[model samples]
Target: MRNGNRRGKPVEKARHFWPTTKRLISYLRPWKWGVLLSILMAIVSVALNIVSPKILGQATTDIYDGILKGVQQMKLGLHITKYPIDFNHVGQICLIVVALYILSGLFSFGQQVLMTWISQKVVYNLRQDFKEKMGRLPIKYYDQHSNGDLMSRMVNDMDNISGTLQ
Candidate 1:
């Protein structure tokens, strides 16, 4: 038999999360633009990557078709297309794809930097509020509570929260 009780542990009651989530969102309301811009850039990046495959495929198809046309005209004396392979056009498409991805990466990087700034500002505000609350609390409250526990509540707990956010 196991040393400990067979029943592992008691299940805790589940807490409703939406209200807390809404409160957090309310805190972020001030930097709505930062969050919104991050989301928008993410959308743009996805769009660019999605369109890239099609453009690349077009360039690939052009190369293959041009090769086939050249072979047919030379071997069978058949004219598939009047013009030869359009290297210039394929080169332009490749350049466009590269530019689009670069822009997407830049936007994504900017969004991450902006969001990091906003999150730090919010964290600073929250910690400052906790400090202020500690100052305002009654002397009796501190006298009754363990100093170490209270300090941990203020510092360690907040650090945990900040870590979770990050």
Candidate 2:
């Protein structure tokens, strides 16, 4: 007699998603240093983003003050050293701003690199371990769960956990 199942391949049984999640969480246990590095990088990048604008604004205010004072000093034939408007001083201030911008950009890039490395590593390890576990799992485990359900638990659920880390 021919196989007469309506679904053709076979219907998958229900899987335990929670156990898979717990297993994946365990994979992250050994990567505390990478995780911490990622966090630190992110924090520094955010702080630089907040601080850069303030520094630039200060530079602008200082230049304006220098210019106003320079004008007053020039009218009295006094040395411009005491004045705020000196071109050299403005140049120095501009240099500082440029330095700050470069530093902030570097920090932001570092955060991205560290986070990507840490996240990818953690995700890779979790997937590998999960795959191994699935292989070793008994046929009876599959008896209660559908293939689609298991796949979703491995892919979608793992992604959800990684997203939480981010």
Candidate 3:
């Protein structure tokens, strides 16, 4: 009564249809915050801190070429009252530039803190949900599978998720 050229046994088909992945994805709701935080941190780290330095450097170059050079030219002219500008005021301007560099570093530090918070929170919630779901599944199910396989899914998969977040 079975099909005409069946290659494998019915039991083999049953063995291949494991339900681990579908079961796991159902419990991933609470970890969204961590995922969002990770994306935010990555974007901020790349865009703000990295890109800002190049932009600031260009701005500094413009100031040096246009304003600083103009001041030098004006100082050399006899009509100083008409084009009054000081070249000896580099001390205060240098301090301001240093402060901007410090501020950029602070932005990077803040992003790291946010990323760590998200990664830890997501991994903790994911582990907790995984354990809870595993506990609820019937014991008869475990009888069909190896303990090592079950443990690998519970521990190793979660560790992989956390490592990936990093």
Report the number of the highest-TM-score candidate: 1
Compute each candidate's TM-score over C-alphas.
Answer: 0.71, 0.64, 0.50
Q: Which regions of candidate 1 fall more than 4 Å away from where they truly are?
A: 1-14, 74-84, 138-166
Q: Evaluate residue 41 in candidate 2 and report its C-alpha lDDT on the 0 to 100 scale.
A: 69
Question: Is 2 or 3 the stronger prediction by lDDT?
Answer: 2
Count the clashes in each prediction: 0, 7, 0
Per-residue lDDT tens digits of candidate 1, residues 1-166?
3444457655545367788668667778999987888889888888888888888888899899888778878788665655478999899989998998898888778767777787777778878877898899999998999978877766765565555544
Over the stretch 7-116, how does candidate 2's per-residue lDDT look in tens digits?
A: 57555554886896686567766877776776786777677778767777776787788778788788878876565555676677678777777777787788677666
Q: Residue 19 deviation, candidate 2, in Å? A: 11
Comparison by lDDT, 1 against 2, better one: 1
lDDT tens readout by residue for model 3, 35-135: 56656755655565565556556556655666665678776873444333333444455555566566656656765676566656767887777789889
Q: Sorted on lDDT, highest at the top, how do the candidates line up?
A: 1, 2, 3
How does candidate 3 score on lDDT? 0.61
TM-score, model 1 to reference: 0.71
- How many clashes (backbone atoms < 3 Å, residues ≥3 apart in a chain or on different chains) does model 2 have? 7
